[model samples]
Target: MKLDALGMAQSTLVFVVLGLTLLAFMWGRFRYDLVALAALLGSVMLGLVPAEAAFNGFGHPAVITVVAVLVLSRGFERAGVVDLIADQVLKVGERLLLQLTVLVGTVVVLSGVMNNVGALALLLPVAMRLSREHNTSPSLLLMPLAFGSLLGGLTTLIGTPPNIIISSYRGDVVGENFSMFSFFPVGASVALAGLLFIVLVGWRLTPHRAGQATAEDMFDTANYLVELRVDEEAKAKGLTLQQLQDELDETIPVLAVVRDDKRSAGYAFYDALQEGDILLLEAGPDELKVLEDKVGLSVVVTPEEDDDSSTIEKQPEHKKDGNNKDDDDSPARQVDTEGLQLVEAVVRTDSMMVNRSVRQLRLHHQFGLHLVAVARDGARLKQRLRDIRFQGGDVLLFQGGENEISESLATLGCLPLAKRELNLGQPRKLFFSMAIFALAIIAMLLDILPTAVALSTAALVSLLVGVLPLREAYQAIDGPVIVLLGTMIPVGQALETSGGAALIADTLLHFGSKWPIVMTLTGLFILSMVLSNVVNNAAAAVLMAPIAASLAEGFDASLDPFLMVVAVSASCAFLTPIGHQSNTLVLGPGGYRFGDFWKLGLPLSMVVMVVAIPMILWVWPL
Candidate 1:
């Protein structure tokens, strides 16, 4: 195919636009969506993408496919499908390795059938709960789960972004769509090998951290510590020390005792009595209030050197002054008069706060929220308080006095980043959610309608039926990702229209001429994997699918094997969470170190390459 001047110009423009987008992603100079939109506008100005075709990707079958998958995945979550599967799989707890085998295997199986990210999302909380109950770090279960999710995506056409892109490209190339299980054999083989490696060797690679140190110990909160003096009217003034256990109101922990300026050791019990005795506690606002209210005591949060500590010690002498005036002047009383509550939240992988310190974000200054401590994986972090950068899945122990920090959370653009303290099966707006999603998937799969139409219908039904409130359902769909997909789809179509794919195909074939078709196929698979890791999987797949199709045409080889290679490889995002949204989602909560992904993922990637190559050759024939 000879390139026309227009085709050459458009191709050059595509590279420029892509370069800008990548620069923006790496530089953190603008929102990703803004970058994508700017690229789209630039493409139009350069005449690379036709004005009419610019918005077509928004309605493209591929875009619809992802949206439908996300909604359907949510529906399955509401139905307890994941929990049900986990319950059966997690029961093999006696042998730790065997349990991991079951857990990884089950997730892989589920990922094959559903959207892999949704599958992981559904299973992650369950894994965390199991870890907590079993006294194990969530780190052990999460890496395997992430790997399994990636593996599972290889088994189905709609399971991951790459598969759907490859399938659509094949339809345009060979006049046929791939069957749902077209990539199953190749995907399954790799999944099996990956599962074996994870169960046997992967977990041993993680860093070891001791279990469950109190927040005070972890953050060295002694700097924030102070003494509280019990007054004659206080309820705790007459109670035994044993009455106060490890926790106050199931939140704060009581640390130690101080009396007459002297500190006592050894845990005190309910039989100990005191007046003018001092107590040391580890807590933020909410728990502190509960301690004051439940025990009929007052809080003394400031350090001993502060006025409250000195004045409380001299309170007997202060009785000579009017008591009401003294009470009104107390700092503790003033603090209580101001409503404040502390909240514990996590930084989600999708959040913008990744790799930024709280001090940089000016969390307290701008958000009216103070960061107390950050927990990652199972380890309580001890970093320079002002210098510690927040990553996705970093559990933030923060102080938020009311307002729910709603505006701050939005401005930060991070996921709640914290797992809600709710039971897995606790009922909350589930019935309606399940029905809407089920109807959408069934409608599309049965060919009763186009997928986008069916999903749009369901989105409306969900809203009307009150299965999903308007605000929440809208928020569920990530607009930035949607816009990126929508804008890129048109550019991909232009590449097809302009014969740019043929040029890429010719260039690759010149180098690959001596290679067997299967060898060439492997080369394409490896290229897709490399591109997927460096760029967003969806964007890489969209660009590479056309080129893969063009190469198959150039060789007069069957398109299925070539497409299968792309499908399997594109979904195999194993090196980093940034490669895929699902990986990012689990990063902070799973407490995964950046390097931890490749510990299990590298072996898995190798397995996929080895297994997928042969399976593609055998299953579809080159």
Candidate 2:
């Protein structure tokens, strides 16, 4: 059939550029955003995308909605909304199967309403704490939780960037976007099936690395942290760390004594433990269980299999105060007026802290941060927090204000291990935060406002109502993702406007000429899923939405089913950690190898495809 196509020269150039761009993304060499930016510039420079419209993608509805969702997710976090839910997940008892069910279920629900990555980050610390409390390895919970986030994101329009992109693409092509809940039927159905597999069977496929890996894998700490609970009438109440060691005769190293929220690290050996003090021990899972059986002391933290030895107590470095050169400053001396926040961070290889003691740097006096604990390598650090010399890969716990901790960590060349828990200084407006988010969803459902406008209004209201601070709202937007979306959108437009997408659709149609229409739909779904695994899902959606539209036109079929298929498949990035941010976030903490994801991910992927295609056809119709 005679059809419109770009000039051969232009189409070839577009093909060459896109081919290189995909290669760059798969190589994983440069950041995806940088690669997208390069593609946009190349298209503009080659006159494929008009120079005037090169940056229009930044203002795309999809990008705005993505940013708004991220901010709103942060607002929910700051308001203590999800944390309250996490408290319930913690109370679900100690059974691994039961724990996986509740934890994955909670994440799935949360992800449908918020950014999936943010939902995972909010629950990650809780998962770590749960492992310590249950005496199991984090590996069993983390991968499932990450996968749950991806599954959950498939269930709603704002749940993931790909959904938003798909919906917006419909508006550009068909003169109207899919309604907010249009995806709910197919998406929610597929999510339930995927989650069923994850909680029931997929978690078993994950590696159990609690005792096999370093403490750094759990919380990026130096040693396994087991909390020793001291009861009022407990036999170990008045005993010192040294006395306990002597009594046990096995020399278990104590890392710190926690009273209330105060932590005493590098404390004197003769200092007696109080009735309610929680002692942080450096022992692993096997020894912790053994200690419980041997002594009357109950283990507060969960056990991981380890019998590792730790070094104890270093001498504190004395640094002179500026006001009085003869007076030494204390690391724990003056608490900041803004309030204290406990933060976990990992020192970078190039940190100025390397080989430097906290006492020497006067961390509290200089940066308003107090070093609470430090762990190096896989070994226990015996030295006190103040006396210990910092090393690369050392995990540090610090006490500082919300803003101060962030700035201080950056200055010290440290990366935070978890999302900052609500800043103590900030207010938690749970009612306002939830109400705002709900109203935004309501507006979109009622068609009173579009998705982008509603979400942007909700985010703005969240900022104004103190649900999330202005500074944090800015931080909530993922920079690389925003850049990638902004750049890729224009290039995607170039692909369609230049007839490149139609050309690809023609080839796909030719290949399926003798096949059933259902087979053609499956081919598009699989293509989108595989591309998403190797690149950003947003990019996958950006590239595939036009192709889906072209294919729909070529087959004289309804575009809704084709667009719906693209939306679902673009989010089925379960095969690799690089496919989605949720997977990458858990990799280090879960101690997961690159290939570990597919162990669970492969079966889970099959489950999604099995469920999604039929559901999409039924819900959207061919």
Candidate 3:
């Protein structure tokens, strides 16, 4: 193909925009959305993408479907559907292989319908508990579970970002979008084969990490030891420790008793509690709040009252006085406490919090966060928490709203020590959420509506009927992902329009012309897979789709086979932890090293290639 001056310039500009986008994504300094927006604006400035059509990608059917799927995933989470299944995951036998089979299998099925990362998150704790119970290394379970989620995403249109992008590309090429189940024939075959390999042989390839500890060991609750004072009117004022334990659902062990200025040697489990007595307790941040509310206990803030405490003095008069004026009228007070969470975090060396105390930082007033407990290595600090200086590596337990806690941790330069457990909302809506989701899937399969429309309608119903709160529905949509798709879609179109895709395809075909069509397809699949591991999978798909279509056109072959290869291979990012979100999610919990992934991932990738190529060719023959 020959290109005129304008055509050549447009193609060159598109290539430059794409190259910079790839660099920004790989750089990891800026958020992906920002990088994509920069690329989009650059394209418009260069006349590659028209300014009038710049925002069209946001309204693209694929983007809408992704948004709807994310909202539905949140609805299912809030409805406790995943939790109900997770509860059953615990009942699977203690035998390592059996437990892994059940756990990985369940996650795979869930990932097929919801976000794969969410599926991994839902089952992570269950996997840890199973490991602790069976005395098996968590390393064996986490990686396989992560892999299973990735595998499951291949089976449906809404399963993964790459699949959605591929389907949208197909719609543009063929004039009709793929049905919800179109990916099923090839995806299911690949997933089943991959699952078998993971179960029978892939797991054995994982490195045996020694001294695998449970969550309790990793978090080290003993370091969070602090004292709570018993109020005169407290419900447990006269109760023995044993009696108190029976009354409360969660265990808050009394490690010692402080009477006057003297401390007891050990837990006084048989001793009766008394007013004004300080009970040294071992509990996480959330547990401390529950104990205070139930037993009328107060955190014994031991730091001397500072006369010039600006944070406290600057508070609103009503809040400063701690008076309950119109408690019934205050919606903040009426809000359910279920959303409140306790999390442990570690201060990094470069954290702004170093050398500052909680009182000085005014954490409670500024961020709505409370420092419930602090842990320092070597020895315990005897001073009050407010007086204790923060240092690098100090482990602190923070209590606050889940969202607030996450934001505050990031702002304060703290790394979370554990994964926050998913909050399965009120149990009443589980059936409703599931029924609505099923109906949407049915509508798509029956061709009653387009995939995006059916999903969007279902998401709207979920919000209207209160399956998911409005705030949560918005939060559920991954903003960066949406922006990446919206921005990259136009760039991809530019590649096609400027004939850059054809140019690249022709250049590659020159070397591959003599190779069999099957080999060419395999090479393209392998190329997409490799690129996916190094960059974002969605970006990989967006970039590869144009070239895949161009290659089919050049070879006079069916586009289905080529696009299928792109979809399947783009999701197979198994070579490294950075390749997929699921892999990174398990990195800390599994105690895995960067190099550890390829041990099992290498074989699994080989298996996927062997299985997927045959399946793709058979289902959508070239």
Clashes of each: 11, 10, 0
Write model 1 residue lDDT over 227-247, tens digit each, in one string. 456767777766655444322
Candidate 3, residues 561-592: lDDT per residue as tens digits? Answer: 99999999999999987677778656655667
Which residue pairs show collisions in model 3? Answer: none
Candidates' TM-scores?
0.72, 0.72, 0.73
**Candidate 3 TM-score versus the reference:** 0.73
Candidate 3 lDDT (Cα, whole model)?
0.76
Q: Rate the local accuracy (lDDT) of all candidates.
A: 0.64, 0.75, 0.76
Candidate 2, overall lDDT?
0.75
Candidate 1, residue 273: the lDDT equals 43
Task: State candidate 1's TM-score.
Answer: 0.72
In candidate 1, clashing pairs total 11
Instruction: For residue 321, give model 1's deviation from the true position in Å.
Output: 42
User: Worst lDDT window (10 residues) for model 2?
Assistant: 312-321
Question: What does the lDDT read for residue 602 in candidate 3?
Answer: 82
Q: Can you rank all candidates by TM-score, best first?
A: 3, 2, 1
